[model samples]
Target: MPTDDLGGRGERIAAAYLTHQGLRVLDRNWRCRDGEVDIVAREGSALVFCEVKTRRATGFGHPVEAVTPAKQRRLRVLAQRWLAAHDEHAPDLRFDVVGVLVRQSGPAEVTHLRGAFT
Candidate 1:
């Protein structure tokens, strides 16, 4: 599969996983001139912004490691844009990273890191 397709599949899996974990998915693939946010969700009174990274193997490094400081900064800006474009509010804000590793056998491995950055 193409990298984009793999990433899309990972995003779908991550969304379902978050829903299963009781987070209401408010948005997916939300975009702006700045960038795109993979997922936006609500958990209790907190608003969550999530980034999903998918890889077929670990040779490049853990998928979560792909979320560098620069990416986090962009996500913060994107979050602000998302908030400005909508009326949703929350007492708390969180940034999460969902790393998906596709395997040739069995199910894909998912690792979720909550509050991954400030």
Candidate 2:
């Protein structure tokens, strides 16, 4: 599959997993002038911003490892932009990473890294 398609699939899987974990999904692929936030959800009083990274294998590195420091900073900025646009407030905020490994002959593996970054 194409990279974009793979990413979209990963986001769908991640959103489903998060919903099962009790977070209410508010948005997906939210974009601004700064960047895009893959998933936005409400976990009780906390606003959760998630970044989904999908890979066919771990040859280069684990998908979560792709979320570099710079990327984390960008996600934080994007989260603030998302909040401002909605005029929403949360008592707490969190950054999460959902790593998806899609195999050709087996079920995809998903790893949720809650509070992966500040």
Candidate 3:
């Protein structure tokens, strides 16, 4: 499959994984002027802005490692904008990272790291 296809598949898996973890998914692939958040879910009163990173291999490192400081800043900015537009009652917000490791065989492994960074 093409790389983008694999990425899309990974994102789907990550979303399902988060939902299974008891998060109410408010949005997926949410984009704003600053950036995009792969998954937006509510964990109790806190709104979570999630970044999904997937890789077939982790030779470099885990997928979450790819979320640089600049990326976190962008996510935070976008999350604020997202809340301003749709949420009537802006709740406490946090950032998360869903790391997906996809293999050719066997089931994929998804790791959800809450409050990964600022």
Candidate 4:
């Protein structure tokens, strides 16, 4: 599958997993001039901004490793933009990274790294 398609699939899987864990999804692929957040969710009283990274294998590195510090910074900026645009507020906030490993013969494996960055 194409990389973009794989990424979309991973986002879907990540959203489902988060929902199963009791997080209410607020947005998917939320974008702004700064960047995009793969998924936005509400976990109890905290707001969550998630980045989804998918890979066929770990040849290069674990999918989560792809979320560099720069990327995390961008995500934080984007989150602020999202909030400002929507005029929403949360008492607490979190950044999460979801790594999806696709397999040719079986279901994809998903790893959710919550509070990945400040």
Candidate 5:
């Protein structure tokens, strides 16, 4: 599959997993002048901002390792933008990451890191 297709598949899998884990997804692929937020959801009283990364193999690194510090900073700004654009508010805010490993064969493996960053 192409890179975009792989990413889309990972996002779909991540969203499904989040739903199964009992989160109420509010947004997906939210974009602004700055950048895009992969997923946003509500888990109880906290609002979650998520980044999803997918890989066919670990040749480079683990998928979660893709969320670099610079990316985290950008995500924080995007979260603020997202909140400002919406009326929704939460008692807590969190940054979460969902990493999907899709091998050439077998089922895809998913790893969710809640509160992965401040």
Candidate 6:
């Protein structure tokens, strides 16, 4: 699959999984001047900002491993900007990672790591 196709599929899987877990989706592919969030949802009283990483194999590494500290920092900044744009009021928030691994001969798998980092 093309890179974009793979990314879209991963995001779709992540959204579905979150919904199945009882989270209400607020947005998909939310962007601002700062950065973009792959999936946004409300889990009970908290708002979730999710980053999705997809891989065809682990030759490089697990998909979640790609969300480095720098990436986390960026996510934080983006989330802050997102909140600012909505209102000065901040909601309970958390960062999450959704790892989607697809294999040509096997079923795809999704791993959701909530509060993976601050």
- Each candidate structure's TM-score, on Cα atoms with residue i matched to residue i, is 0.99, 0.96, 0.93, 0.96, 0.99, 0.93
For all predictions, the C-alpha RMSD in Å is 0.5, 0.8, 1.2, 0.8, 0.5, 1.6
Q: Which stretches of candidate 1 lie over 4 Å from their true place?
A: none
Give me the runs in candidate 3 sitting further than 4 Å from their true place: 88-90
lDDT of 4 by residue, 41-65 (tens): 9998899999999999999999999
Better of 1 and 4 by TM-score: 1
Pairs that collide in candidate 3 are: none
- In candidate 1, what are the lDDT values of residues 1-118, reduced to their tens digit? 9998999999999999999999999999999999999999999999999999999999999999999999999999999999999999999999999999999889999999999999
Which residue segments of model 6 deviate by more than 4 Å? Answer: 87-91
Report the C-alpha lDDT of model 6 over 1-118, residue by residue, as the tens digit: 9999999988998899999999988889989887899988888789889999999999999999999999999999998888877753336799999999987876789989999999
**Models ranked on lDDT:** 5, 1, 2, 4, 6, 3
Give one digit per residue, the lDDT tens place, for model 2 in 6-106: 99888898899999999999999998889899999999999999999999999999999999999999998999899989976899999999999988888
lDDT of 1 at 67: 98
What do the candidate models score in CA lDDT, each in turn? 0.97, 0.93, 0.86, 0.92, 0.98, 0.90
- Relative to the unseen true structure, what is the C-alpha lDDT of residue 79 in candidate 6, on a scale of 0 to 100? 88
Better lDDT candidate (2, 4) = 2
Backbone clashes in model 3: 0
Clashing pairs in 5: none
Worst 10 residues of 6 by lDDT: 83-92
- For residue 60, give model 3's deviation from the true position in Å: 1.7
Per-prediction backbone clash count: 0, 0, 0, 0, 0, 0
- Which candidate would rank higher by TM-score, 2 or 3? 2
Error of 5 at 111 (Å): 0.5
lDDT of 5 by residue, 55-91 (tens): 9999999999999999999999999999999999999
Q: What is the lDDT of residue 84 in candidate 2?
A: 89
